[model samples]
Target: MPGFSPLELEALALSLRVALWSVLFSLPVGLFIAWLLARHEFFGKGALNAVVHLPLVLPPVVVGYLLLVLLGREGPLGQALYRLFGVSLPFTWQGAALAAAVMAFPLMVRAMRLSLENVDRRLEAAARTLGARPFDVFVTVTLPLTAPGILVGALLGFARSLGEFGATITFAANIPGETRTLPLALFSMTQTPGGETQALRLAALSVLLSLAALAVSEYTARRLRARIDG
Candidate 1:
C-alpha cells in the first residue's frame, strides 16, 4: 500500500472534525425547526417547509455558490461577522462544515419531525393537567420520547456530512491539511497519478464509517424504543 503523508492524515482528521462540528451545530436548530413544523400551524409554514427541503433538490454546487455569496468576506453577514467577531468563513474548514450542515439539514429535520409526530399528545396533556408548564412537559416527556429519533437524525447527518464533497470543496477549495475532508482527499487522489489504490482505500474507509454509523443509529433507535415501551 502506498503510504500517506502527515498532510494526508491531517486532512482525514480535519474531515472528521468538519463532520462532527456540522452535526453539533445543526442538531439544535434541526430539532427546533422539526418541532415547529410538527406541532405548529402558522402563516408561511408551507414556505418554511419548502425552504427546509430546498437543499435536497438544489444542486450541491448551487448550494456552495450561494454560501460563498452569503458568507464570503465581503458579503453582508460575513463582513459583519468579521468586524464584530473576528470570524471569517470563506475558503475554510468551517465553511466546509457549514455547507455540509446545510445540505444535511433536511434529513435531520425530517427524522426529528417524524419522531415528534409519533409522540403521544395525551401524555403532554396529562402533565399540563398536573400543573406542569409547557416547557417542562416538553423537556421531560416529549424530548425523552423523541430521543431515539434525534439520535438517528444526528447519525444520519454525520454520515451525510462525512460524504459531502461537491459543496464542501466548492466552498472550502479543498486545501490539503486545512479544508480537505475524506471525500475531498479521495477526489484529490483520483486526480493524481498512480493514486487509484489510495482512492480505493479512502472509499473503503467511507463505506465502513457509513455502515458503522447506520448500525449505531439502528441500535440506538431499538434501545430507545424498548425503553419507551418498557
Candidate 2:
C-alpha cells in the first residue's frame, strides 16, 4: 500500500464530494424520468427516449461543450442565473458535480426504467382493487419492490461520477481543492513530468473505490430484495 500524500487525499475527498452530490441531486429526477418512460405514452416518446440516452452515446467532451454553451458565464441561461441570483457554476465544484450528473444520468435512468418495467403490473392492479389510491399503491407496493433498482442506479451513478473526467474538466477546469477530483488529478499526474508513480497510485485508488461501490450495491440490493420477498 502506497502512502497517500495530502494532495492525493484531497483528490479522493473531492471525488467523493462530487460523486455523492451528483447522485443525491440526480436520484429523484432519474427516477421520475424512468417512471415516465416505463408508464407513460404520449407524442414524441421515441424522441424523448433517444434524448435521454444521448449522453451515453455522445462523446463526453461534446456533452461538456454543450453544457458550457448552455451554462457558461456568457451563455444565456448562465447569464440570467447570475443576474437573478448571482449563482455561477463555471470552474466550480458544483459545476463538476453537474457535469458528472449529466454523464451518469443515462445509466441511472436506464436501470430504474428497466426495474419499473419489470414490476408486476398485477401487484399494482391488486392494490388498486383493494381500494388503494395510485399514490398509496406507489408508496406501499411499487416503491418497496423497486428499491433494489433505485439502490443499484444510485451506486452506479456514484461510481460513474467518481470516474468522470472530460466533462468535469471542461466545465470546471480542475482547480486544486475545488474541482480537481480523482480522475482529474490522475489526468494531471499523467501529464506532468516525473509523476508516473503518483498516476499509478491514483489509478489503483480509483479501481478500489469502484469495486467497493459495486460490491456494496450488490449486497444492499440483495438485502432489500430479501426484505421485500419476506
Candidate 3:
C-alpha cells in the first residue's frame, strides 16, 4: 500500500477506467467486424481487414498522430462534432480511451475472427433449418460458440489499453487525474529525480494487472472449451 501513493493509485484507477471504457466501446464493433471478415466475402474486404489491422503494423506514435489530426478540435470531424454536438475528444480522458481502443482493436478483432472461423457452420445451419431467423441463429448459436474468443479478445484489449502509452499520451496528453494512465505515470516517474522507487512500484503493478487479466482470460477460455467439449 505504501508503494501505491495517492498519485500512483490515481493513475492505476484511471488506467483501469480507460481500459474498461476502451473495451466496452470497441467490443461490439470489433465483433461485427470480425464476423464480417470471417463469414462474408465482399468487395474491398481485404482493404477493410488491412485497415482494421493497420494499427498493429504502424508505430504507436503514428496512430496517435493520425488520431490527433482527425479528431483534434480544429480537425474536420472534430469541428463537425463540436459544431453539432459540442463534444470534444482530444486531450481528455475520453480521448485517451479512444486512443486505447484504436490501438487495441486489432487484437480484439483477430481473436474474435479466429473464434468465428472455428465455429461449426453446421450448427448455425441447423438452427436456421429449424425455422430460426438469421439474427436469432447468430444470437443463439454463433455468439455462444464464439464467446471464448470474445472473452479472450476483451482481455487482450484491456491489457493493451492498460499498457498504451504513446497513443494515449500523444492524443490526450499526460494530464493528471484525466489521461495520465499507469504507463504514463511510470514514464513520468522515470524522468523525475529520486522517483526510481515509485517507478519500480508502478512497473510491478502493471505487470501484476496484465498477468491477472491473462490468467482470467485463460481460465474463462478453458472453462468454455470444457463446457463445449462436454
lDDT of each: 0.89, 0.93, 0.94
TM-scores of the models, in the order given: 0.95, 0.97, 0.97
Clashing pairs in 1: none
| Count of clashes, each model | 0, 0, 0
The segments of candidate 3 whose C-alpha lies over 4 angstroms from its true place after superposition are 1-3
Candidate order, lDDT descending: 3, 2, 1
For candidate 1, give the lDDT: 0.89
lDDT of 1 by residue, 13-62 (tens): 88789989999999999999999999999999999999999999999999
**Residues forming the 10-long window of minimal summed lDDT in candidate 1:** 1-10
Candidate 3 residue lDDT tens string, 44-83: 9999999999999999999999999998998989999989
User: Any residue pairs clashing in model 3, and if so which?
Assistant: none
Model 3 C-alpha lDDT versus the unseen true structure: 0.94
Which residue pairs in candidate 2 have backbone atoms (N, alpha carbon, C) closer than 3 angstroms, thus clashing?
A: none
Best by lDDT: 3
Decreasing TM-score order of the candidates:
3, 2, 1
lDDT of 2 by residue, 1-230 (tens): 65889998999999999999999999999999999999999999899899989989999999899889989989998999899999999899999999999999999999999989988999999999999999999989998899998999999899999999888888889799999999899999999999999999999999999999999888999999899874
